[model samples]
Target: MKDEAFDPVRKLVAPGTTVIWRNTGSADHVVDSVQFHDTADQWQFRTQTLRSGDSVVYAFDQEGIYEYYCGLQGEEMCGVILVGDVSLSNSLPCE
Candidate 1:
């Protein structure tokens, strides 16, 4: 259950779209807000420890860039989500 690399780092969705974070990795991960540094407003969402098969979903209602990390260094698991009319992404597969 490990495909942490060689995939889309993050996804941008439109407002009202639900973004799901599915952890298929063998290792446990904390899907928190890139360390929550000062940018409290930016850290609008987070997830509990997600192990293999575990998942989290977030519905975007605002337009902005949301950054996230896997709470692990070296691995440098970082991603960015741009919400808005950014080409009307449908990859989220959620309403």
Candidate 2:
């Protein structure tokens, strides 16, 4: 998803796969980690601020549900990542 407020924020993909986060929004946004508070740590893990039209690719090596949000000066837009299995797990019911 490009916009931070993009609906249906959760997406499922296979494990060891590469996913792209495109900054189609008009403002600056960050695909930050929910764990570490340091921006450098985010950058170290390939999660960082993405300007308008820019994008970042992250490879979900592990299998689990990942929660993330926009680390910017705007609304608190959050999203979830379901890795490894395309089918809905108990944590995230199917729509």
Candidate 1: where is the Cα deviation over 4 Å?
A: 1-6, 35-41, 73-75, 86-95
The CA lDDT of each predicted structure is: 0.58, 0.60
Per-candidate TM equals: 0.69, 0.67
TM accuracy, model 2: 0.67
The TM-score between candidate 1 and the true structure equals 0.69
* Per-residue lDDT of candidate 1, residues 1-95 (tens digit): 14453135557678778888777767777666543223213655566777878888888788766666665422366565667744323322112
For model 2, which pairs clash?
A: none
